[model samples]
Structure formats: C-alpha cells, structure tokens
Target: MILKRFFQRSQSPARSCYEAIVAAARHPRLYADWGVPDTLDGRFDMITLHTYLVLERLKGEEPEFRQAVVDEFFRDMDRSLREMGVGDLSVGKKVRKMAESFYGRIAAYDAALAAPGDGLAAALARNVFPDEEGGPDIAGVRRLAEFVLTQRARLAAQPVRAIAGGDVRFEEPGP
Candidate 1:
C-alpha cells in the first residue's frame, strides 16, 4: 500500500510522527477554547494540527524536524483519507494538495498576525471563507479559536505517543 512506499522512502516514521504531533499541538490555546462554538460539524483538531505544522515549517527548523513534521502530517492525513475510502495514489495526491493549501493558509495567517491591529481575525475569516467578507463571521471565528485550544490540548495530552497516544486521539464533545 502507499504506507509501505511512504515508510520505505521516508524511514523512521515514529520520529517524524512525533514531531508532527508536537508541531500541530503548538497553536495559541485561547483561540480554540474561547472561540469555537459548541455546535459545529467536522473535527477542528486536524485544522489546528495543520496550523502548527505550517508555523514550524515557516520557522525553518532543522531538516530532520521539518521532514518528521511533514511525514507525520501526511500520515495522519492519509489515515483520514483511508477512513473516507479514498484510494492510495489519490490519497497521496490529495494529501499533497491539502498540505499546500494548508501551508498557504498558514503563511497568510502568520502575515496577518504579524501586522498591527486585529488583522489576524480578518485574515482568519478570509482564509476560512474567502468568498465572504474579510472579517470572520461569528461561527468562523469561533471555530478558529476552538481549533487553537484543541491543538494545545492535543499536544498537552500526547507528550509522547508510544507512551500516551490516547491523548492525541480526537474526541468530539457531546451534542
């Protein structure tokens, strides 16, 4: 399967996986905890993870750290694709596309965050819904904030996967 090729070429999936998990967990927590509403569909955990991965890449960490984060991100994305019944090559391609899109969004978000004023909120709103206005709609902002918190929680929960893998596992709040 694709995992075989991915592992063979990449090698040491564990280290890479661990780094990705850490990177994904590094976003600002207040966003996720105070921002997202109780009622939304889809898991924000993945989005938060993607954000941290992008930030880490931007920071220009060592190659090993970068590769590990990328590998882990792809692995988790592939797992999500598989669960959705996507085929191997398709999953690989889609994961790449998703990563690119995610990176682009992260860059945009970082730029916004660096700027003065409440630009980050506007940038996030635009990123989340480009078709709409620049500022975050009520729900979109909430989701973004929630994602930040969730990412922090995920990282905190999973300090070490082999020892605490259960911590990173996504759990939806009760309706």
Candidate 2:
C-alpha cells in the first residue's frame, strides 16, 4: 500500500502542476523586483496566489484533476509545517488555518480580478504587502498586480491538454 501510494504520487500530473506553481511562486524576481516579502508569510501568500491562478484556469477541465492538485498543495503545506518543527498534534490546526487563509485569498483575488479599476492592486497591496511602517510599497504592489494579471492571461492561453499533461510554464518576472 505504501509503495503504491508513493509510486502514484511520483507519477501524478497533479504533482507536476504543483511543482510548476511552486517554481513560479518562488521566482526570485517576485521578491527582488516586485517587492514580495521574503518571509514565510510572504512566500505562503505567493504560493497561494499562484495556486489560485492555476486552479482558476483549470475550471471545467476535470473535477478530479483540480482536486488532486488541491490535495497536493495541502500535503505540501502539511509537510512544510512538520519540517518547521510544528508538533504533529498542532499540524492539523495550522493546516486548517492555512486552508482558511488560502480560500480567503482566492475569494479576494477572484473578486478583484472580476472588478474594474484598482481592485486587483488593492487586493495585492493588502495581501502581498500587508502591514508596513508608513505604508505598503505602492509601486511594488502595482508591479506585482500587473504580473498577476499577465500570468492569468498566459495561463488562459495555455492549452488545457498541455496543462492536464503536467506541462505548464510561467513567464519570468522582470524589474
């Protein structure tokens, strides 16, 4: 049973998609040029944002495929918490909180993207930049918002077959 599960995980398309999402979220330019914080919360927000974009694009593709990807994301979060020395008993609670945060972010981004004007940028500022001494970096927040919109369009252009085949690409972020 254990080996079967391991092999399935290794071979899953969902795994590949999750990896691509993580790679995109971890792009150095996001932190350096776009001004996303390099801290744990910042990284989490980035990953969550990227995941939302992919999952949004995956709509109507296949319910199972989306569920698999979501499962992989939660599994990674659980693993990360464990590695960070979170107690096993506490892991579930933290993962739950993470889920709540993820869903809230998804809702925020969805609403913002669907709205006109500076909604998206405002959401990005609130979530990506969070609290700052004077205020969040407006230029950086705008840049990041632009990057997110561009990625959304790029993902939309990708063939569903290609995405289902575990092949996905994200354009590099720039200064």
Candidate 3:
C-alpha cells in the first residue's frame, strides 16, 4: 500500500491538457468567425498548431514528463485514426505520415514564430488554407498566428507544476 501510494501515477492531468487543447482547437470561432475551413485538413491544422504550442512550452522540463505527453499525443492520434476507419495495415503508414507532418510543422512554426512581419501568418496560410480554392485567408491567418503567439506566451508563463497538474488555461480568442 505504501509503495502504491508513494509511486502513484496520475495520467489524468496530462490527458486533461490534451483534451483541453483539442477542444480549444475545435472551437467554432476558428471555423465560423475566423474562417478556418470547417474541413478535415483545417481541423488537423488547428490541432497541430495547438499541439506545437504546447510542446514548445514544455521545453526545459524533465525529459520523461515531456516525452510522456508526446506519447499520449500520438496515442490519441492512433486511436483517432482507427476510429476514423484507417485500416489496420495502413495505420502505421498513416501514423508515420502524421509524425512527419508534425515534425515538419514544428520546424515551420518555429521559423515562422521567430520571423517578423507576417511570417507566421504566411505559414498559417500555407498550411491551413487549401491551395485548390481561394488564396490564403490573410486576415484569418493573421488572427490565428497572433493567437498562436499569445498562447505560446501564456503557456510559457505557467508553472510546470500547474501544467502537470492540468491547471493550464488558454487565452480567449479576440473578435
């Protein structure tokens, strides 16, 4: 009993943060008010942005905890793929694709954030806006880029204890 109590591991906090990020990404303002297309690709882009922000904020933490969060993120992705009917045989390939996409976006978002004068906006446009239709929604992309930066700042300001305890909160979107 003492061992169990001493070594208790609570996964809820991390999972809750994951859930919160997803819900925030799924907010309707992103789709309706901000004009992020309410399509699969659009949704994926939003989630990726949120995930990237979280991962960035997690920098400098204990490696194990950070990796635990990443593992959970991929576990969620795998489950989502299965639920969405990605075949068992193809799931690996799809996950590989997802990981590649995640890594690429991380690099891209890092560069965009570090860049000046609408760099992040341009990156957002390139990723979230479909090429087959209208050109990037520059205005909406601007808002989302700002949103990403704002969230990144807020997350950095949070204490690792609070974050690990699932006490994270995202700033509300602007009008």
lDDT of 2 by residue, 55-106 (tens): 8998888678888888999999999999999999999999999999999999
Give the distance in Å from residue 51's predicted Cα in candidate 2 to where it truly belongs. 0.4
| Model 3 lDDT per residue over 39-76, tens place | 87787788888878877888777556567666777888
Listed per model in order, the count of residue pairs whose N, CA or C atoms clash below 3 Å is 7, 0, 0
Error of model 3, residue 136, in angstroms: 1.2
lDDT order of candidates, top first: 2, 3, 1
TM of each candidate vs. truth: 0.51, 0.93, 0.87
Our model 2 lands, by Cα RMSD against the true structure, at: 3.1
Clashing pairs in 1: 16-68, 31-145, 32-145, 32-146, 32-149, 35-142, 36-142
Could you report the Cα RMSD, in angstroms, for every candidate shown?
A: 8.4, 3.1, 3.8
Whichever of 2 and 3 has more lDDT, that candidate is 2
Candidates ranked, most accurate by TM-score first: 2, 3, 1
Off by over 4 Å in 2: 1-10
